[model samples]
Target: MLNIYKMYSEFLSSNIPYGGQYASVVKLLRSAKREILKLIKTFLEKDEKKPHIGKHFVPPLMDAVLADYARNFPDARESEVLSLFAAIINQYKVAMKDEVPRIFESVFLCTLEMITKNFEDYPEHRLKFFSLLRAIATYCFPALLQLTSEQLKLVMDSVIWAVRHTERNIAGTGIKLLLVFLNNFKKSDFCNQFHQTYFMQIEQEIIAVLTDTFHKPEFEWHVMVLQRLFSLVESGSLTEPLWDASTVPHQYPNNADYVCECTIKLLSSAFPNIMENKDLYGEEAAAKLLRERQRMLLVLGLIAPKMTDS
Candidate 1:
């Protein structure tokens, strides 16, 4: 029998080393795998019950299984790992149907942690790992049904940091996965943290790269970041993106007027009554653009013929 109690006790202990062993963790995870599947199968077969949110978000049994699985990564062989990976993948693909997370709780989170901790060291397994992550909620919602905000944030941060951008598909997978988390994690410190460091560069520096990719109709990419920004705007946090319309990089790099017009339009929609309120963007600036809807003409007219006198 797995000493799940002891294992979880150790994982919970904040003590630095905790004699943490992966073999024990792996053994614990493998042992619980069958039981987890059984529970998921039953959950799917049964009638819906009102969600019984336990005192903790995760049950003790699931927590123990994860802690023990983390113990196994050290000695696990690449060839021997196919079954575990397959189980996770299969469970993920059918997860939403089951309405549960099919994997052990700790294992899923710890797997994400391991990926982030070793991302630079293991370039080869990045795709395989990212694919598994992509299936996480979609494939196996049972175990993840009651995910905490903190847990979701960790997964989001890890997945976002994993994309090295070798190919468009890989980039798409990574970004798509982050989009999932971003959609769920609205108004959290995650965005604030991302902006302080990485996302600022993603927008301020790499807007051209992302926008060009989105512009291609075949990509079918969701402009999820904009959705998130709009969600923030609706929630009264973000009014609009910070990029200056004229200077924001774009495929039609010469079309500064178009960019400015789009920014003005979006800002107008995002901030209610800006046009009607003279105290805000000024009756002149907002009125000319909003009432006539010729945002470019209005802005250009303001700056254009002034050059004629010079």
Candidate 2:
């Protein structure tokens, strides 16, 4: 509901702790959260411009809430940064709308602080945070073509660091950011510069870093890294049909079979595309149908892991 966005904007526009009254504070906070959830859904549905939501609203709101908490509970060690961010992100579509990249900037940069404090507290939400980061980039960058070379280099640095030192969750996040940066070529001038521009140069660097990390058996199970590359292949293959059109752009061609097989493997061997296409396999195709359910089951299994530590 547009009303949701308007409500947050109004709250954000208001003076928090207004008149420093207890009743007023509680009401504001309660209403603010309610509207925040609503806005998240409203934002993500639109294209990536995310106008009403940005550093202006999100950052200050977080600071106020976090500051208040810290003041009351001075010993607030390892709290729910990821969850809070995840809540916003989960509902980002409805709330973020036209302001995706700016939101990406706020999120990607802010997530680093979690590492500075308590990284383990957020391992559960780490992958999803990165996934949301990519969603922002995928929708925003090429659409507006705003990321410059400097921003791109910074992104590359972020990727390398996450790959080398952090946990698999962080590595996966980094990989997604890198993939989003690379995919940005679709809207870049480099697309016309050469048969394959220097933009493609990052592919090798990403592969090398991720492959080296994969060597560590502990991190090998991280399907996100593999999924990063898989995502690129999938994007290319899935768009082949669009490229086949006369009016649509078709400068390059990625092999569809390569993408299809990789996608299938990712489903069976590891992460299932639980939110995968509904029509990918019609009810008539049992093999394909079984595969879809297997993916769905796998998603539930991973997300809803065993309750007790066996």
Best candidate according to lDDT: 2
- Highest TM-score against the true fold, candidate: 1
Q: Local distance difference test, per candidate? A: 0.46, 0.47
Report the C-alpha lDDT of model 1 over 42-130, residue by residue, as the tens digit.
Answer: 44334243134222222443344444445555323121122334343453355233323444343455455444564354443456556
Write the residue-wise lDDT of candidate 2 on 59-146 in tens digits.
5655544333333221221123334444454444344444445544544555544443554655544555555555555544542355
Q: Name the 10 consecutive residues with the lowest summed lDDT in model 1.
A: 74-83
Q: What TM-score goes with each of the models?
A: 0.39, 0.38
